[model samples]
Target: MQSRPMPQVAGVEHRYVVANGIRFHVAEAGAGEPLLLLHGFPQHWYAWRHLVPLLAAQHRLIMPDLRGFGWSDAPHRGYGTNARVDDLLALMDACGLDRVTLVAHEWAAWAGFMACLREPGRFRHHLALNIVHPWPDHRATIRHAWRMWYTALWEYPLVGGAVLRHWPGFTRYILRRGVTGVWQTPALEEFVESVRSRARAHAGQALHWQYVLRDIPRLATRRFRHQRLQVPTTLLFGEDDFAFAAQSLDVGGSHGVDVRVVPGGHYLPEERPDLVAATVSELFGTMESHREEIVG
Candidate 1:
């Protein structure tokens, strides 16, 4: 319900826009074509901090704190991925964005996939970072499921809040371990301290809870099979990511997505910002030019 002071990132403009009945905190930077940056758990727009400076010059970056993270108003409800997807679509509408090049990390990457699938017109190109694709092979994922044990500690209702509140070390460990020793002092501290807020803790819990209860079932049921990713997408999977192993995705289901395994851990934005920025430029920059040519 209350927002804490956000650390100042040079040239990054922070504003609160009313969308989905909540005041979502958005961090905007750069110029040129629009690029939407959605972050993952235990992090907000700051997750894109490392990437912002890299991509700020050539492209406009619109980074938003998903419903309950960062300085955004963390309401009790609207924690599920579908709800987050809706929140983003509404946020874009409120901001007058007809379409954007999506650069999303972690769970937000998952939701970004869903958004592109449901409405291909909303996204020009997608650069998904360090998350499994929508059509994950159930058998392969289950084999790698143990890697996700950490989610249980923070996915439950009351237990997750207690973990974030009482023991900040656990949260710190999760943040640090996700990156391959690339994370520095203040970045980890920023995310850990943000989730320490009671409201933010609740928001974190609800986000994970929805994942465990709702999204997992959808994955098991092949719910996404009914949908297809029409947007041009490149899925960047970190080779040493703690959350997922080498995925065995369904060949039939993978049509538009191009999955590439890169060097690093889960946090590509921090560990491999160079690769992230280059890929963003390649995907978004080229697409913008092609669009201009067609329109011109």
Candidate 2:
């Protein structure tokens, strides 16, 4: 099936809620079982703009800008993993969702994993894109460094923001550089405009530092274990994603979790929305069928 065009879904709603002393901006569409989508650094809810409509057809999709990104309040403090987890929980409670299927990409993947570790029951399943659990393996460390150069740059107070703002048309250049292969014209424009929007154009780049400096290895070591996921989980990565070495995908699939390889690079959803939608639909369908079998 061809992926639907950008912003096809109408009546998109936005709201703000105070979570962990910081306000978060959330976007919502459809109504059914809740699916919470967490975007990585330098991006916001717009990352899921393509997948939301397809998933929203059968699920209520909640996409949040997260603290320190997008139009959300960006406080200088409480940007840690624990704080992000708490913010998600608070957002869910504010939305009246007791449990949700969580999907995350890049830095948001760590936040999603940390949320599961903190309260497994709160999440029904997890879908991770392009980010490996930061275990203490040499391969994983090297891959993390390769994919996360912006994190170090963003940590610098005045220098990072200055660099991003000083270079006119830098956002467009970065977006193009981050992905491989040709993208559909409209899709590429939408992605670029979303990044360039006033709400995100500047703050999004700054938030990258917060995600990078967080001790991911220490957090994953303390949290991610061999425990069985109470709900079905899947990991999706692009074959050409230069962000990490091949071994990075090896860490989390040992426990019957499904792994999906798609075409394109790190920005798979934007680059190949049709494939992403189909994969997610299939995974959710499989999970539902499995649950039905057990119940029967």
Candidate 3:
């Protein structure tokens, strides 16, 4: 494989590991508790560039280009949500990470939700950004239907790939329009180019198609009745996130879910890394306080 210059972030190291049969390119740094950061569509681990430097000072950060994104292998198959979760689990096994604090955004949040539910003990806490839990409210989804209009275009196979390949501006347009704070930059262009790979483009489309075809149908049937998240969870959303409505994503009053509406938009990690880092630090501080209380 030809080596390409990784996006620079001070003190971060890059490596690759075979997890669940797929080789993953991971950017890691720091020490102490393991913190796994998962990036969303049209982005690789580089999406966390701003947030990583701050978090790396305190935690052993493990940021991977989720399966098909970034420098990771874009396989012809294994784009399913469960498969992604399995990949994380395998990565943990390969790295000897028995437990971790999970931080994820967008599509990766869905997989994190499942991983936390599946093995609650393995995750100390979950700090989810700009995405909702699995328990979808039909009425809320209906009311916020306009928010997810982009999914329609990506749910098809060839159509999605064609637009991604031919229309270079389409992905960039989505990122620019999605965020309230950030303007066009080199990072946005890099992300747009990452998905231009036919394999990654197909993987992105498959993700959307699976949600519509497999995930939604299962949700309708209450397939997740057996799953419950026991890990402490904090869901932070941007007030202006174009994809998800802040009001509609209230999973509060449920066990272990804490939702906070912050000032910003969809790309919270990039748009407001300070807020993201502070929120995470507070969560960890609270956890430490609780531990001390238990010890005392």
TM-score of 3: 0.95
lDDT of each: 0.86, 0.67, 0.83
The predicted structure with the larger lDDT, 2 or 3, is 3
lDDT of 2 at 77: 60
* Model 2 stretches with alpha carbons more than 4 Å out: 1-9, 168-170, 183-207, 210-212, 216-231, 255-257
Per-residue lDDT for 1-296 in model 1, tens only?
Answer: 44567788899998889988988888999998899999888888988888878989988999988887887788889988889889989999988899988988989998898899878999988888888887887889888889999989998989998899789999988888898865778988998998887888988899889988998898889887766678988988888899888575545435678888889998988889999998987886687689899999
Window of ten residues with lowest summed lDDT in model 3: 1-10
The Cα RMSD in angstroms, rounded to one decimal, for candidate 3 relative to the true structure is 1.6
Off by over 4 Å in 3: 1-4, 225-227
For model 2 the local lDDT of residue 78 reads 58
Residue 224 shift from truth in candidate 1, angstroms: 1.8
For each candidate in turn, the TM-score is 0.95, 0.81, 0.95
Stretches of candidate 1 off by over 4 Å are 1-3, 249-253, 292-296
Minimum summed lDDT over a 10-residue window in model 1 is located at 246-255
